[model samples]
Target: MAQSSDIEWTDATWNPVTGCTKIGRGCDNCYAERFAERWRGIAGHPYEQGFDLTLWPSRLMQPEAWKKPRMIFVNSMSDLFHKEVERAFIDQVFDVMERVDWHVYQVLTKRSSLMRAYLHKRYGSSAVPSHIWLGVSVEDEQHKGRIDHLKQVNSDARFISFEPLLSPLHAIDLRGIAWAIVGGESGPRARPMQEAWVHQIRDACERDSVAFFFKQWGGARPKSGGRLLDGEEWNGFPWQIVPKSIIEQLSL
Candidate 1:
């Protein structure tokens, strides 16, 4: 089954792969790891392995059963590009996505370089399908290089998630980007995000003609700080990249 998500940006979550190891400070308080660890040692639980990297080939065809078109966040529980995930498994995931072309799949990852390399090898000079949107996660200025990696991909549906915006990305370039989602950390060890940091990216998006969406002001809880930014909500989306067929079905 495609898990329905509470996340504001996407409609559902599909986890063909689960579990990941930390490679950066952004992974310190990962929400996926936190949730999965709770079920450790519990028999019959999906996360019984407690965040140990595992692949579920059974779930690859899960999306094919869903009739209605929607935005599906691929691998919400783990990164598809994680080094441990086999290239064959990743190919299976992509195959399912290509076959079930009705839903828009958002494949986000912090492993930007690996993702770029894989996409280049898979599609080569050909354009990636519009139904599959590729994106990378950027937590701070130090990791802004991920954006450059994302730009190297040959896809029109490119995006970036600036969640847990830890530092100011002053004068950051947003060219060749279709959308950006900004939000603060939300958990027990949640770090504070400065308003000045958000303005920099929002302004850059405006200047670059990229759609910007402010997810939350995250606190102890996901909604502890509310979604308002400068007295209004920012819920921008890139409708241009969405396939016309999906858009038409969504309206119904």
Candidate 2:
């Protein structure tokens, strides 16, 4: 069963895969890694291996069990497009999404290279399923290239997640993007997010008329930090209608 996620951007989570190795600074203090270690004692625990890039074939069909429509975050605990994930397994994950067309799956990946390569090999120029929204995580200026990589994929909708925001990003070319989600880091040993960073992104989204969602003000305790910006929370979605054209190509 999919659990309702605390993540404000999406409604539910489906972890067809779990556990992943650190590939960037965003992985330095992964909540998934911490959670896995906390549950290490459980017998045959999926994350008992603790962020070792494990896959759960049993979880592949979870979306099919859900009868109602939902906005699902695919692999909340891991990256579905991780290099270690086999192509056949990726196909199986997609199989479920294609079969359970009632739900909208939002797949976010830090490894945009793998995602782009896989999509090209599998779908080519054909349209991506309208129910599936693809996204890439960009925590800092260095990771911005992931956005360019995401543009190459053929998903019906494409977006970016700039959570745990570390540094300021300038001249953000939201040219081909559908949505933009921004947030600060949270938890003990947490990083501080400057107000300027949040506003910069907000302004960019406004200029491009892209949908912007502000996730949280992550500090040592996100609950205490809250997600308010300039006095209020920004929770917005990109698509107003189904089967809309990808936004980056539009001239603002």
After superposition on all C-alphas, the RMSD of every candidate to the true structure, in Å, is: 1.1, 4.5
**Per-model TM-score versus the true fold:** 0.98, 0.92
Number of clashes recorded per candidate: 0, 3
Error of 1 at 97 (Å): 0.6
Query: How would you encode candidate 2's per-residue C-alpha lDDT over 156-235 as one tens digit per residue?
Result: 48989998799999898887788999888887878988999999999999988888898888887766688789999787
Model 1: lowest-lDDT 10 consecutive positions: 243-252
**Relative to the unseen true structure, what is the C-alpha lDDT of residue 146 in candidate 1, on a scale of 0 to 100?**
96
lDDT of 1 by residue, 77-194 (tens): 8999999898999999999999999999999999999999999999998989999999999998789999999999999999999988888986699999999999999999999999
| Deviation in Å, model 2, residue 200 alpha carbon | 1.0
Best by lDDT: 1
For candidate 2, report its TM-score: 0.92
Clash count (model 1, backbone only): 0
